[model samples]
Target: MRLLALEASQNSTYYISRYQQVEEFGADLCVLNGEGTEGTWPEDRYRIVGSKHIDDIIAAARAWHAQQPFDGVLTFSEASVTAVAAVAEALGLPTIGFEAARTSRNKLLMRQAHEKGGAAHPDYRFVPELEDALRAGEEWGYPLVLKPTLGAASNFVFRIDSPDEMRERFPQAVDGIKDMAWFTMEADGLDLGPHGLIVESFLDGREFLIEALAWDDEVYLGSIVDRVTVEGDTFDDDVHHAPTSLTPDEVAAVHDVVRTGAWAQGVRRSALHAEVRFHQGRPYLLEIAVRPGGGGLDHMARVSAGYSPIEAVMNVARGVRPEVDHYTPTGVHTAAMCLISRAGRIQEITVPEEVSGSSQLFFFKVTAGPGDVIKRPPHGNNILGFLGATGTSFEDAMSTATELAAQIRVEFTD
Candidate 1:
């Protein structure tokens, strides 16, 4: 199938890997970007509209479609979700609808939709300023989550344990969101609805990341991974393991909640990245992103569960129901984590042959290069890349992953 992936306001470089995956899977892929670096893709297959505005993007896409029609339109970006929906609608192609796209992209809208649809979620208040955040903190009490309305990869997300921390972090979040690539990369001239901070009641329990698909009145959990991250004030450090340890009953409960949340977000037929966390021994919907999960999650899904989220994306874009079923593990054990380090400009990153050439290694990618700034929490949740390994058990997998991670050295410019 001929597919077109849209990157409205292409602010990040990681999307190239996703586009390449489409081609590697034997699909004819083309890219349309509102704003992108020159030569990021071949001239024959890439087009830039030169403006990050919705109108310009639609016009450019319409012109391109008239010349060479695309069988499907899609995106692998949190920022471009709504833009792709708009383009697909304009071109008379299959879409999850613009309303679903908007609600999925904005946290405040998502919470409101979930509440209206009776999906279990945390109480949230949109805070536009520090004063608003302070009032929210007072009302919601301490140990609340302060996050941006339009956010991804946990950027500008903080766990406020006290009012003083709320006071200290509110201004940083306000300043950081101004330049946050996730927010800034959105196509202009759309009513994004509450483009600011939100204070949410925290869920204190284990978290699960699910790669799922939503069909007509049904949702399928393709791959389920456990978020084994050690919690901190900021949520930058993420560690994951699979096959998940959820009991069959727990998995069914998670599936029901995910289905409810997906319908609540008006996502009827699309690839979903649902994040569910527990509170008081019950699952609550954290989010339902209208795209596949990031990092080596696609690889994890294939290896650990015998499910292919990338293939699901392609199928959904073409308006075809993906071949998916309820969560079923292939009895494979793997562990993965985001490569994080202290803040600085990257000078060199070295992965020793022992780690790189190991047979247990399944996934590795260096996202940062020389001269790239690596920002940790407070500034941003910048990552070096991803590393995943397989083993006989969860402990063995995690041990191999961590040990190999330690051997991969990163040098920063002082």
Candidate 2:
């Protein structure tokens, strides 16, 4: 089988892992990378920044298919999901449909679709201007969450407690939209139109991520990941631990909510990433993505389970049902932590030998080095590196990972 991957990045360890898994399945991999990412994959390669134009992507795919037909068209990145779905539809291949892909990228559309499908979601309003946002504030009341309709990594996500705070922070939020618009405009079909924001009623609760694969309209529940976020002023992810701390019954309820959200988005065959908030014994859908979760999520899944989500997604792309036994705990716990640093030029980073040599350590990757400038949150790409570990229990795994993460000293220049 020949697989055509859209927008494969060499910088991603996850992408490289998935490529290796595909080859392990005896499938020939052909990558269509973005503008400067040409030499990432040594195999058959094509260059077309898929986000720039769907037609160009389809044209390139068609030309490639003429020589050797591709058995599957897929992508794992959030940026390229819609484009890949468009190409798959053009080729009469399996996909979640362009509408679903569009909805997945836009939070406003996602909330509307979920509500229409009888899936519980927060009350939201599409804010196209400051007036609209103010109106939404009046209707939704205080302590609302304001974010871009299409955004990732919690960039520009603000929690407005009152109209006064909204007035003060509204400009910054609008600026974020402008910054994001620069990229969204270049992406062929993803235009936010003037100004766009989603004001949602804030739900107070614990958050969890649902990782699953859907095939033949049946959702296979994978591990439910417990997400830890930075407290105060930002919603950036701090750590992820799996299998979840949720009880069996709670996990099942989360799974049902995920299934409903996935089906509502018309996701028949794809890797599903759903974020939900549990409040008062009820799970409310936060958002869903038709791509695999990032930050070594697949790695944690492999450590906690016996199978890889990357492999399962590949199987789904090839129209094969993934052999998955959901929520079957492996008697051990796994955790992944992001290496965050203060904003400045990195001078030196030291990882303790003891921590590095530990058997519990799964992998440690550093993306920043000397002279590399580090920015803080709202930039959404502030992570300096990542660390993963496994232990006899969730507490043990989390403690080990947290301690190891603390041992890595990152010195920044004055």
Per lDDT, the best of the predicted structures is 1
**Which stretches of model 2 miss by more than 4 angstroms?**
8-14, 24-26, 46-51, 181-186, 190-195, 347-357, 369-372, 379-381
Report the backbone clash tally of model 2. 0
TM-scores, each model vs. reference: 0.98, 0.90
The top-ranked prediction according to TM-score is: 1
lDDT of 2: 0.75
Instruction: Assess candidate 1 and give its TM-score to the true structure.
Output: 0.98
Model 1 C-alpha lDDT per residue in residues 249-332, reported as the tens digit of each score: 989999999999999999999999999999998999999999999999999999999988898999899898988988889998
Segments in model 1 whose C-alpha atoms lie over 4 Å from true places: none
lDDT of 2 by residue, 133-236 (tens): 78888886888888877677677788888888778666777776666522453236444232467888888888987678877657776767888765665677
Which lDDT values do the candidates have, in the order given? 0.91, 0.75
What's the true lDDT of residue 124 in model 1? 92
**Which residue pairs of candidate 1 clash?**
none
